[model samples]
Target chain A: MSAASLPAGEPRAIPTAFAIAEALRIAMASDPDVILMGEDVAGGGLRPEGTEEIGGIMSVTRGLVGQFPDRVLDTPISEMGILGAAVGAAVTGLRPVIELMFIDFLGTCLDPLLNQASKFRYMFGGKARVPLTVRTVTGAGLQAAAQHSQSLYWMTAGIPGLKTVIPSNAADAKGLLLAAIRCDDPVVFCEPKGILFVASDVPEGDYEVPIGRAKVVRRGSDVSLVGMGATVGMALAAAADLERDGVSAEVLDLRSLAPLDEDAILETLGRTGRLVVVDEATPRCSIASDVAALCVDRGFDLLNAPVRRVTAAMCPVPFTRVLEEAYMPSPARIVEAARALL
Target chain B: MTRPPTTEVLQVAYRTMRTIRSFEEALVALVTQGRLGGFLHTYVGQEAIAAAVCAHLGEHDHVASTHRGHGHCIAKGVDVRGMMAELFGRRTGTCGGRGGSMHIADLGKGMLGANGIVGAGIPLATGAALTAKLKRTGGVAVAFFGDGASNQGAFHESLNMAANWSLPAVYVCENNGWGEFTPTAFVVPVKDIAERARAYAMHALIADGMDFFDVYAQAGEAIARARGGAGPSLLECKTYRFLGHYVGDPLVYRAKHEADDWIRHRDPLRLFEARVTREGLLTESNLRAIDVDVAALVADAVARAQDAPFPDAGELLHGVFATSDAEGAR
Candidate 1:
């Protein structure tokens, strides 16, 4: 369903970050077992008499501690500690939604997610469940520099047990986050920093988007433009430009990366006979290459031409605005790739 | 000094220590015979630390262990037969043959897992304690790590958070003198790992790791404080490992005399037996009877583990996720 057609109580316009915060609030309110923990999640722990809380560096967890003060905890600047504790808490019956602040910091605390949470169920012979949600900001264009702006969901998605999802807009942020928090398995909810302030209609209360399902945001019968997170908006923009040039482009927003929707990719490939995979992540071993491989391996006959991928350069995300702009994939790049396929 | 433990507690402590010693000794034999595969970090000389500290924990309390964690597992009341089967890579094992010695776990018994990565369990235990505190379960979580793991970033981070949040966590550093092949002193400049606790404003306590009574007394205080919402503490147990870091190691790092001296003079099992017999707390006959029973139990576990079936091929992809369509695809 389109954003305009969502039910009435849904806010007409809400920032994507606030939408995620709303999801956290809803999750904590729904289950007493749900808790939130991250650095600055509750702002300055020992604030001055009348000073307000900072919520978080991005304000995604703002106004949460006010409602669930005890559950929304402010953790020390320790990604490893925060993630490891979340895994421990999940095993011991608390559903903890932890924020890693930035995806790049995953290097500091990846053992908990990679070794512990990902292997718990399998290693324990199905006896254990780690219902943990690790929320982090990803993608370039915010001038967050190399350390903070890189998209590393591909690394987590490469893992077998962990479920990785990225929302294209505000509504999916709420639904997918709620789904992730309630899911029995460990999930990595990636929020694109570029789209954090992009306003869109978001449902008010509780809702869920299935973990492995993809949504075709736009329908067409020519080249299928595949994108996720911030790139979905870019793909749609490129599709609009292509439409003006008498070319129709179908845009698919891949919500989940680990349990990839192969059926959707092949189905769109079957209809369009051409593909352009757009990703904000680097070129090698990314979702774009994955989709390109999927088409080559399974839907080889369906492709009228070789699938094209519009992805970021292999270099690290640069700090300067000019270089950062050059680092990320643009709508023009996506349109160029789509036209090349056409 | 704390009051002496009751006769029953003392007897149970002796039994656990004896069982750990017997189990590790049996593993040494198994490794020699090439019956067991993979890395084996035996807890032969350091049995008293795990046995004594685990005595204070119940089923509701949780503990995260280290790579050398069989002693902690047995002391925490995990099924010896299942643990043995796990070591042998059998379907009936605790992890269904998925996790060997370094990864055995029983959530029902509150043993989170025996981690393979150094210092990884510290945050896990800290988190579990946070869960207990937030849920008001009155449960405490203990992280049993080695001296080498004390140098890890996770160790500092977990302790800082535990202290900051007043989480019901107990950080137990099983200072087995050696971290792998190297002496802890070579890597760690500080005389006492517990001294690091002062940075976090946490209570720091040291214990004779070879003495079960000392460990029990110190651990009891820390666990009690945590359970009572007094925040976390660090209990550094000065102990030593009898064998090499793993089964196949050449162990050329330390002098043979160093190992011989510890084994002869400071063996935890020997110390326990001497103290209990001298104090008239337990008779020689009683200790021997318990030892006999433990030997039989260990033998039976070995027999069962040998006879247990390997996991079916169909079971390969199971248990990766609680629910996923990708199961068995690989």
Candidate 2:
């Protein structure tokens, strides 16, 4: 893969959605194999004279249809059908970035994800590589209720063959998305809809935050706040609050969940024995529960207190504004959990 | 689109049908003798459909198959020894013993694996067709599913998607009378599965699956239409399976006379040999030679498979991910 086709360097402030779009543009610019397929990936209906284009519901893939007309295919609303086809397309020569619309829709098309895409490499004895990237919206805050709003990265992470990644900021969004697209394995990229417009400085061209690594967004010594996607922002906010009380809290962004950055988790846990896991997903067998187990199993002596987990209430995501807010794990909740652990 | 197949194509087609017959008979013997284990859905009566359809495809053309897929694999040129080894759970199998009988695949030959899940291969084949369309490879993909699969959502979804995208794909429903114990008529409301194509606005064809010449002629038009970028088409073959759903099944649902009639009257291999011999297209002696050669080939495959080893313990965790182990799972 040559890097010259990329839009040249320099960091700029852009929303997470635009950052992901930039990553896609760079991938398509550099490699002709990268193609986009999904429902309304381009808002303009498949009519000849429809002048308007919504790009996507969130416009994460805005302007890509015109840039690469042949590559940005607007598929019919058949989730299982299109996803299965995308898996086929990936095993063949092309790299397909398919939009599942929402992570909740995974239930409708679990066969392609769990049985086909994830098992092809293994079942075919490593002869075929399913280089498919599923970019779906996750997390709740936008009143997009029970069906559209749960963060289910843990489901994909549990599957042995799938790599799950979620970025907390604009820069990581661009880099990690590019990494997911270019990687040769089937990657389920959880793009938290709650932080779609969260803006920060992102590098302009081709870059990759490798899929399995973690980023220590903020360093502290008293208690380590581990988070993923939107929860990372909450962890940072909690770190600021904890610092006011003279208790330095380290914030770790678990960008990739499947290749669960075990070494990084242990390193951060070793440095700060007290750990608080902030997640928007339910606590039952979640990433939070896994990390807490990882700490106890591997870094038992390093602990100064029992591990803490601040997660969403174990119920359906509510549509009401106040109920949803209460359902979500806020920065105040993270601080409370971190303080309890300290 | 319906040009008659050449004599050479007929010879190859006959050999393919003979090979499938020999392979399935060998598996039946093995299963009966307690040598083979698990679900073994043999392609006993439906050889002509796979042979006729696959003859029109090139090496790069892809084929996605269902549980009853050994014939499709052989017609698509999968290595017989590898397929045999897979069923034997040997190391040198097509999937290194990982997929077993239900999941033999050779992508290099464009044979997508025999899927365990019903109706899954429809979209995979459609995806392969989409790849051919995008990459400009001049290739087409074929999905061979059962009468049962047409009821699943994948069948409808893939048909609509392939037609909408104008992809190069041929969906062949080997309507072998039964959908695993129950009559296809009991589950599928339509008399012919090809009628389902009208919903997607796709072209449809029906062929006598037991007659190789008829299936070949019909499949030729469908495949040619797809290759010429005329869009997707469905070809339903009215066929029957002479065996039970799986090797160990009691087959209590269907009367013995029903299977006896199909086996006696409509065996695809017998029909193929009789036609070729009757029209002077091929002699009985030539067809007999093929029968002889196929038996030897199948016997050799079985011998080699029996001698091969199962994969080592370490390999269990090796291929769970690309170039990596199922990490952290000891």
Candidate No. with top DockQ: 1
RMSD in Å for all candidates:
2.6, 2.6
lDDT of 2 at A234: 90
Give residue A149's error in model 2 in angstroms: 0.5
Instruction: Give the DockQ of candidate 1.
Output: 0.78
Kindly list the per-residue Cα lDDT of model 2 for residues B59-123, writing each as its tens digit.
Answer: 99999998998999999999999999999998999999988878888989998889999999999
Task: Compute the interface RMSD for each candidate structure.
Answer: 1.3, 1.7
Native interface contact recovery, model 2: 0.74
Query: Which digits, one per residue and each the tens of the lDDT, describe model 2 over residues A73-125?
Result: 88878899989999989987899999899999998899999889988888887
Q: After superposing candidate 1 on the true structure, give the runs of residues whose Cα lies further than 4 Å from its correct spot.
A: A1-11, B325-330
N/CA/C clash count, model 1? 0
